[model samples]
Target: MNQSFELTPNRLRELRGFAIAARLLNFSRAAHEAGCTPSVLSRRIAALEEAVGGKLFLRTTRRVTLTPRGEQLLAHCERLDAVMLAMAAELRPQGGEPAGRLCVHLPGAYGRLCVAPVLARFLAGHPQIRIEAVYDDAYVDLVAGRIDLALRVGRLADSQLVARQVGSMRRYLCAAPSYLAAAPALHDPAELKAHRCVAFSGLRTGTLWQFSQGRRRRSVRIDPVLSCNDSMATREALLAGVGIGIQGDYMADPLVAAGQLARVLPEWELSTSPIQLVWLPGADRAPALRALIDFLSSEL
Candidate 1:
């Protein structure tokens, strides 16, 4: 005799709730994806936890993080992407050429020295593409600022946005020959405290210069005689023999070779920071932005 049983889909709902929560790793964000309130999402997740007999997330005031069980389950679930591009002749118009205004952001010095030249070629190649480039040292919110793309330096934290590393950034501790001659002998990073330092007020790491020698690392707090937020002004001060300053490779390399500035602390070096081409979460679906990103990654 066959046993009478009612088939239920509570498990399916539980799986879906768990999947969205695990992907976003935040109740609010996952709730947005599920088209539900965060409180409702929380209850769904709780029901899922009870059905699975384990807690799936570690909740906190700041953020929600996945537990081991959540990680394992997420590893098996298919990826959910914000950007999906379908390339087909059926989807193309008479002229499928991508054309539009593309707004981009970059650091002032990096944009002028490195990116502008490449962007020049990209614009020349695409006649219909117009660009509005904003150069600022401050980090701008892609969504709030309505920026389509940006070139970023250094390490990036985990985010829903996509990043593609294109190149590297190198910084050096440098001074003019006159300043080095007038200043005291500076062989170690500890000596920076004794010498005059030109600080860039824009450094995310503050006034301290961090260095690494072999496996050992050290950070020295700087006391600057002159501080400037502008890279050009800082470079001028370093060239004027006012004080030692950390300079980007683009500006320092050419000048150093010409004997305008000397690189200090040759033994201790700053790690190479990454140059990333970053964009919004769903921006890959945009043809113009995608082309520009590809062009930059290839040229740079």
Candidate 2:
């Protein structure tokens, strides 16, 4: 009869391989992280499953997701890894400042002017940290796309995602000097019906221009002569004297300054949109994520 439990090399290797694979959720990514190939990683997972007599993954060509049992095992693995890392850091002679890869998503306009400056200084201060910035207007799925942080505009939907208000932006009604010269004098939002209005299709307002006067707010529907999905295109149309336009302040500021576009109804403020920095709730603990938030909050 055996008195002591024998250590098995196959079981130990499988345990390590499974933990890494589970953490990444992609065989190719896990293999790359482990300095191996996907084929080898797949074989390791298969061997691990055979040893445990249970399947750990459900494979598909397009996506790799965690199974019920895999999620449970992943939690345990994460805890164990955290404990080990903590122990290692405590035992090490000197572990200086926080450092890691921070993935951030930003709008194209804000990223160029606002985010870039802050990131430059942040990188200089924290030499060890790497920033991955994704700038786009399209919707991104954070968890599935592996995004660490995102910058958003306008009202936010009620959700589990954590948000921090960075600043506010306003929309302005503008037209070229030449175009406004020939058009009828605009006194109110209702007058937009007579003037040719250039529309950006992305704006949620349904062919309706909303404005505010003192404490009163009103929405007036209009028939725009031209429409485009992008602000850049709309700006071009306005430059060509196609029609008047409603656009964001940041995009309008330069044109307004250059006298290419004139802001109409400046005294009356319309809708004000808020800028926000959004991230997954639990990602606060991640060093890179925290660093980015701190940098942006201070700079923006």
The TM-score values for the models, in the order shown, are 0.72, 0.65
Model 2 Cα lDDT, one tens digit per residue, 15-54: 5668888877877677655545677667877876665556
Candidate 1, residue 280: Cα displacement in angstroms equals 1.1
Can you write out model 1's per-residue Cα lDDT over 1-300, one digit (the tens) per residue? Answer: 013311144544456667888877777777665545677667877876765567889988887888887786676544422112344333444487767788999988888888999999999988777899999888888878989998888876635356889989788899999999988998889889999999888776869889999998989999899988878789999999999999889889999999999999988997688999888544656677888999999998
Clash count (model 1, backbone only): 0
Query: What TM-score does prediction 2 earn?
Result: 0.65
How many residue pairs clash in all the candidates, one count each? Answer: 0, 0
Give the per-residue Cα lDDT of candidate 1 at 300: 89
Where is model 2 more than 4 Å wrong at Cα? 1-95
lDDT of 2: 0.76
> Local distance difference test, per candidate?
0.80, 0.76
Error of 2 at 3 (Å): 27
lDDT of 2 at 20: 81
